[model samples]
Target chain A: MSTATGLRRLTPSSFLLFVAVLAVAASAAALIVVYRTGGGIISDQERAEALAERDLLEQVDVEQGLDTLAAGVTRRALFATAGQHFGLFDARGQALAGDLTTFNPEFRNADWKVVRVGVKPRYTVHVIGSTLNDGAVLVVGRSLSNLRRFERSIFYGFASAVAIVAVAGLAAGLVMNFLILQRVDAIANTAERIAGGDLSARSPVADGRDPFGRVGVSLNAMLERIEELLTGMRTVTDSLAHDLRSPLTRVMGALARAMHEGATEDERMDAVEVAHDEVERTLNTLSAMLDIARAETGLSREMMVRVDVAALVEELADFFTPVIEDAEQKLVIHAPSHPVIAHGHEPLLRQAVGNLLHNASQYAGEGTVVRVSVEENQDTVDIVVADTGGGVPEDQRGRVQERFVRLDPARSSGGSGLGLAIVAACAKLHGGVLRLEDNHPGLRAVLEIRRV
Target chain B: MVEDDAEVADYVAKGLRETGYTVEHVPDGRDGLYLASSSSFDAIVMDRMLPGMDGLSVVKALRAASVETPILILSALGQLDERVVGLRAGGDDYLTKPFGFSELHARIENLVRRRAGRSVETVLRCADLEMDLLARKVFRAGKPLDLLPREFKLLEYFLRHKDRVVTRTMLLEQVWDYRFDPHTSIIDTHISRLRKKLDEGFERPLLHTLRGVGYRLSEQP
Candidate 1:
């Protein structure tokens, strides 16, 4: 196959196959060397045996005659003790002695060789040949089946070892892949659940030191922020509906009374007046809510400029003092001699301060002292409106700043509960905060805004 | 009057006619612009949203054509930014929607009055009641009257638009620069106090209440 095709088919098994091929090649080369060396050792031993037999025959010839030595029983006994075959051939190529019935062609010229001798059980032998003193040929052979068996055993051992190593490597790789995929699948499942609107679901962070763990942590934080914003929006919508329903119901009732059959002309006029008043009140509430909403949208950033908070407070005090006096309340305004400047929408700041003052003199009972003060620090400008009347309870102080949260509904005057909410929105828009504090005997509402 | 909604147009036109002013109504920006440029009118009331063209563009087009009639923008967008946009587009005044007719009438009267008196006047007088604008003082029958600063401003707005009905919203806006509704009867209380100073000993009352509408300060009352 082409290299590209081989690479495409390469997997964990393919890697193991490559390792096995390397091991098999090495084992086969080693076996060939061993077989050749063993055969050489066998051939040397056979050649020594044939020489010893010739020397013994020579000795016998020296002692006696050649004809006598050839017919002797001593040669047969020597071959049997050596466990080898020895044949002597004369000049005419005829077998002379030592169990050689016929002459072998392979034993004619070469010095040594491995040749098969028997047919029934096929015995391979290492054979050595030499020319004798009387011009006769002598050949010696030794069986080599044991060396072949050893070679076979080595080959089998190497093959099995390669197979075992490759299997172990592939198993390890698969186990690691499965573990990683399980972790990744867990993360994906959590993401899917969150996408399906189950924001309560969170990604599992097993090891925070890992990259995936960090990503999960960040995602969970983002989800928390989203949930918080959604909850806040829901609360605002619910309260808006609740606050608008009252005036709407009153208007509907007045109109129904006006349309009733038993209503006289005076009663009809009174109903019309009542409906008009209720409609105006509803419009006022809606407009105030819109103002708060606008501040929250952050669209007023373009209108931001350096506002003289002290000047604005002075103006509000001037406008409300008469109205407060008419309500039979004492109004005191304290402003710094130097200009107290901050960054915000001037009109919105005026409205926020005005709302606070309005709340103070209106909610705080008559004969109460209402004080308006403007103070500046290094970072913030605080416009505080304090009254010496019954203040909001400690727990209710925070709740009172929420939209449409009216305390003691039975004690409500003509004002909607959106004034402080608008003030809070404006404070947030200006990158500041609103705080409600106790003035010992009354409520002190402070609107803190960032300074330029 | 130029308003796209037929109901609103008829209602405003009828109200103006009942107040004894000759009125003309158009329900589209194109027609309104055409009539405004071709004919002479004392004043124009334009809605911000119209059929053929928007009110701001119409005002821009009229100003570009040199039609110098005073224009009052009537818009449902009551934001301070919207008010700034309308005035910058050459509208003499900006009135938010769902307004009381008395408020609309008062704004339109002020716009027309501003256009009529282009030359600066230092003194304003309604019969024996007189205000010296440069001196910031008020006099009745050659006798000096002591009035609070806010009352003086209230009387000054009245003197500027004498004999015309001024709504409570107008007084709050023109005098105190407050654009919100007065939750209490602050204006009424202030007006009663000012009346005590202006007509307490005088035979004739200068400030007359038009129930269900507003107050009209005139010699006849």
Candidate 2:
């Protein structure tokens, strides 16, 4: 089976073979036609020469009498070359004069016929015979060796042409097959390596100049995306394990304390409350992680609708104003009078904006001026949540958007460390991005989404 | 409540009974559909996954039979679109699994009350606090209380469900039309501001925060 497949791979495609066959067939047809026409022309010339010689002899017999014709035939026979011959016979079928010694009864008429004469070296000839008025016979003939030689040459020429075409077609087929196999093998090798658990393997044939090259480029790109997703999945699981552990441990400790012997009612109640709060926090973290995953995977895209960006931001600002004010931060809004509408998932967008504001309220210290603004462009809308407090350091801005990457080791801010991650996911779901920029002195988070 | 899991069924049934609701629990979707269509109930808590039939099919069947009992779908499928699907399948509300009893109870009460269909009232009053629904205005002790649009909505929601326990999730969904949970205490802050506006100079506090559950607005409280 393997050998059969290998042979199949080595062979050129049937389409190429079909074209080669058609080319050979056309050459054969042309050669056959030329052979037929050339042979007919040679035979016609030979027959015409013999008939003209016979007609001249008949004229001599009619004008000068049989005795003169016989004398003429004898003289021509002596001077004739190996290809020329003549015969004269009496009424008793006896040879009168000529190099030719034999004749057929059918040659007695004045019509051309092919007859073989001579001994030791038989020669085929076109001959014509006529009975003179004195009851004598005259014959004239020519050898057909030249016409046979012409037909033999045509046959040999056609055979050699067919041989050359067959050899050349096979050679071209092999070379083309090898080139196609080389390209196919490059893709297959990459696929085999990937199947064998090498996620980073890529086809080396991605030239993007031909169909095979284009396929290779797309395949490599698909592999790149798969590798990225796998890496992301790994990080998410690792962080999830790490993040869930501490809260769970705290819950267990609180429960252990609550179950301790001789514990006072009030202390038991407090421990239970603590455990409950920790459990709630853990559950929130879990749900937030789920939300981020869903958004990143575009599972929430079906909920998208036309939402007014300005109105959403303004309402969120109003919703968070009291919270920011309670933290001793001033809250302000900058939006146009007209609505800035965008196609987006309303709930996710609201959550994303809420998360940004919540982050500001938590990190932006007292007396910070927090500004919420909505800017609209032709195809995109930007929701900017900027704070005028101690901003995040430039280097940490990008890292903060990743899940479970808290700047504070103590985790005193009481966040799930997934807020920015959720915001980024929401932005991506909306075919946009979340950019953490400098607010001069504070962090300015711009959540841009498409307005289609 | 229709739930395949015995533990969940017991927990919900016991909680509803403790809250003065006569609860009937079915452990399969088919049985739940039979009971719901044959008899009457103020509300139904339907689990999404069940034996005999799925919750969505059961809800669709009951609706097709013109059984208008309010249904609250309880499921572990808490994605945004999943919620939409549940509501579109004739469920009155959708609650995710691992929910607190108070959240479930509050939602069930909201569903049942909405089904009861009270005539629309223009003025809502709790003690001396009043809201003119058409005017979109609020007043405490007959003095006009200046409120923002969101504040007015919040007050209107509280007045509408005046003496009932409303969870934070409920308020988030109803007042702001938001379905995602905000990690910050943004709702508490809004409620506090509204509380200040309603009872700053008054002797009695109408808005009461129930620790670990949610808030309640009642004249007796």
Candidate 3:
């Protein structure tokens, strides 16, 4: 089948349609020929019948008043006709007159006969009427072998025509299907190349405006779009690197110069702190980018195990209480009596909590109460960290979860803008969701992970 | 932060010393390693970039040579990749440059506290209190003192802190340094535990919180 397709492929739909069209045309032609030829042939049969009647009239007195010589001459003339054959039966179906005939008395009474007489089947009829002296009837039959010969030739011609038409249909359909499959294969090959990362690859354009050509055009457009996006990403990364390096170099230079100048204790200390903060900001940016990249691989979330959510929350509350108190903020922790165990990476879960605490202290009013709570259910666990501060605008809240997407200006805040990003990354990495919700007068960040 | 960048090295060193730590200064890794190896410092403030060798390699060398001094690798290499390399290279902890003085102080203390737990005596002792490591026995001046495991560690850090105003960060770092969660109140919980253990039924209160700073352990009560 594959070889046939390679040599001459014919899909069944196209082949059936082509053959149908050809068969319709051939059938119409055969019908026309059969009618024209059958009319002449049938009329000839009628003429033969009339001639047989005339012969019967000429022989009417042959077995009665006619001399032997005249009867013999009439008989010879009647017998010479191609369809002539005759037999006469008495009232009781007894054979009375015949020539070169065998009698079966039981067959003589039939009104019509499909008889094989002289090596050919023929249709004949017998008639009986009161006009006969002894109530005898003549049974006659004519050979239809000549008609069979004519019908056979016509049928054979039609059959050959059908065969030729079928072969032609198959040939045409195969060629057409092959051409279509070739064009389709070209498009598929181009797609494979593009999937293999050849963004410049394009489908072969067909000569005319077939579907393949239109598909090629659209595919090229899609490839162009992908290339544009990739280029934009590269440009952004380059710009980011360049922009970050300039400030870093300046910071380092400033620190280096202060030391080279042999500054006083206070002067040197001041320079160090400024430079240190700058470096930390840079590091925070880089870590945010890395976290985004890792999450972009769709969050593998490894080694998830049952976790004591209450213990974790209580732990965080204990860890942050001192820091929060030192910042003059009130830290309140609420954990249920039962262990609210979830399944996820402990470090990532902890990091998310840390980010929440860190972010709250930096943004929330220093003396406000920050509440941390752990709530659990049969199938899931939730850790909520809420702070009363200038809560993120509903519009900016979503963007804040993205790396470097701090809607608030960095200069106005001490944060590196990575705290929320880290929270977002850690939440995702633990197969959990981090959402910013309205805390009424404050903002609430909730991290919810499913239980194993 | 024995950073060759004198400006950075001074504040890091000063900030550290101001936080009640004894910090020695060195401008290069060679001197840093020499000072670290020659004397058993509680913690070494390592600057990632130095004149003689990079900070990562110095830590790696120190670790290779079996020098158990906890090194807080300070670097401007703020990238995650750099942090990974620093930590993987035997740095006990990592501190990005341009860190707040408080953060730097906290991290240094945290690193030291973690290392202190590994080799320091498992049996912690404080003012008329003796804890036997093998025996798992606690005594208040030769009288058996019943205390939970948490109370023991809490008192241990208090004794370690001695009379200094040990902040909450110090307590958390010193006692539960294994936990990465810095947003919780484990310190307070542990402090209350120690208070219950050491202060209960006693004429003396050995553990005291210094309000904004930390707790202190003393016999002055």
Candidate 4:
């Protein structure tokens, strides 16, 4: 492909300028050809008028009307001599003698210019009447000067018009480039900066009337979303350290006191167990925190390695099959025939799906079905984990995935309340989304990732 | 000197007394200033947000009086601005609440020990004991004494204040960071261990105990 094809290409200004110059040249050529070819009829009529005037001159001593001052000059000689200076005509509207020797039929009755030689020469034969006896008129005319002048003016006009049009085309080309391609260039530059790690950069949004402006608005919206997602992520990390450490200090204190002041072996053992539990809680919290932080900061776009979504779903199903059987609960995984691929971090995605399965197995009652499905629908890839347990309420579902929020059952059952929240954070980090819906009989949680 | 939150004041005051400090607790900025003006302390523990005069104003007043008392500020606003306010008010150190007790006590003790800057350096020895510090170790009768981290720090502070009465609160601030007056047995506890290791086999003990007041490290047996 040419540099002007695909992604890398020559800009629109050069392209428009090329087309404009080509159009001007083509127009000038066509008009020049028509003026030269079809306009020869005017010259042909002048030549015919000269021939008619010459015939009239053969029957008359056109210069006998001149007095002693012109005695040496013959009629034909004087008429021809005068033709060198001007075209001459008699009363008959005909050219008598000149290089322009014919009277064009179309112009035979037209009044002709009549020039007579001599002042007070008693001239009577050089007249435009029957008295001249077929001396109706005679004109001695110069050849082709008017036609040449007309053609030269047309050439000059064509040259000036082309020059003016070319300059105007240049001006219009610059305006077109700035208004159209230049705006695109501005957006591209901003995108380049953002790609180069300036997340604070934003496209200059013009009025949202033209396509470029609309694109600017759209890009700004996307960039705003990106900025918000990143800031929220930062808050979560800072919150993690600040919030997690407070509880940890108290736990460490309790354990330290128990170690130092426990009265008996049993008391010491109890304290040790409690400390171990706190440590475990801290680890679980950290795991959830890292997952959410990574997902919220748009880490997925840089790592677009493809993974088989269907295979992952099947593998998860197989891994959890034994647990399901042991719980006397039904487990079913539905996948497409063709391997549906999604760009993602395989380990993280698997962990997310695993967490869902773990939740389902723990919360969904025995002898109940835990349905899992991974499917692709045009622009989206969805991994769903649904449980036959009581569905989350409409009002509560939104809050369920927030950090450290859990339904009553999950909370009572010793959950950290961070499972769904982590999942939501992961989806957002990947520029994806999570949807919580009722499965009519139970709750359906969907992890919807965009197919990049 | 801290007069902000009641709970924190109680915690810090009790921790200080346990570390062998004579603590005069106040409730708010007004009372704190009145107590500070009327009394003399080796060090002042100022809390940033007080009821009336505030920790900043109190410290400012103290500094204005040309009272070069070593002051340590306490605050719960752990942000940068709070620290600036404390330091600008002439506090020698700034520690936020929810802090470890040991750290606070240690800071206060160090502040006071430095404040009592004696002009002449005093040589400290017990029972014809002699040691050269330029050599980086101590010896008694040409035998080196193996000291733990805590014991070494305790001995060094005592050596620096050789001829003076080193209070338990002074030792706590110099050694441990316990800031409250829990009236606990921390000073006695650490002193016992230090005595056992340093003067166990000796005929006379140089470490002396002052009942109802505090313990002191002396050069006489």
| Top candidate when judged by DockQ against the true structure | 2
Q: Write down the lDDT that model 4 would get.
A: 0.65
Candidates arranged by DockQ, highest first:
2, 1, 3, 4
Candidates, ranked, TM-score: 2, 1, 3, 4
The lowest-lDDT stretch of 10 consecutive residues in candidate 4 chain A is A122-131
Candidate 3: tens digits of C-alpha lDDT, residues A1-452: 88787447766565668567868686768767895779567646654564565356435644462333234434654565665555554566555554324444434443334454432343342221112444554455444545566667667777777777777767777787788778888889989998898888877775537777888788878777678658746854874676487559869876986687668877777777677556655655665565445543444344356778788878766656656766678988888988776776664566678778777776788778899998776676888999887788898888788544556654455454556777776676666778999888688999877777
Give the higher-lDDT candidate: 1 or 4: 1
CAPRI verdict (incorrect, acceptable, medium, high) for model 3: incorrect
Worst 10 residues of 1 chain A by lDDT: A73-82
Candidate 2 CAPRI grade: medium
Task: Judge candidate 1 at residue B179 and give its lDDT.
Answer: 61
Question: What lDDT is reached at residue A310 by model 4?
Answer: 91
TM-score for each candidate, following the candidate numbering: 0.68, 0.78, 0.48, 0.43
User: In candidate 3, what are the lDDT values of residues B12-84, reduced to their tens digit?
Assistant: 7677667677767878878777777778778787888889987777898889889988878887755434555
- The parts of candidate 4 lying over 4 Å away from their true place are A1-211, A295-308, A321-330, A335-344, A362-368, A376-381, A395-399, A402-417, A425-432, A449-452, B1-221
Candidate 1 residue-wise lDDT, A1-452, digit = tens: 69989788876555655755675577668767866786567556666776675567656656885465556523663546434665667757776765544566777654557676645666666666665557666665555654566567766865676567556756765675576667777778888998898978887877777777787777778777678667767887897697678778888999999999999999989998888887877777777777777787777667788878887788778777767887788999899978887888876787788788878777788899999998887898888999998888999988888887888677357677788888998898898889999999999888999885
Off by over 4 Å in 2: A1-15, A26-172, A261-263, A336-341, B182-184
Q: What's the TM-score of chain A alone for every prediction?
A: 0.55, 0.66, 0.52, 0.58
Ranking under lDDT, best-scoring first? 2, 1, 3, 4
The candidate, 2 or 3, that scores higher on lDDT is 2
lDDT of 4 by residue, A1-452 (tens): 66447335654765776778796978688777868774576655655665565445434445454121122223444555432322233444455433333333323233333334334542211212122333333334433445666788777878787887788887888887777777888899989999999988888875888788888888989988888778766766676776577558868876886768535877776676666556545655664565556556554444446878898778666655656665678988888878887777655566567667767876777777899998778988989988887777899988878776667743455556667776786677555888988888787889988767
Question: lDDT of all predictions, in order shown?
Answer: 0.79, 0.87, 0.66, 0.65
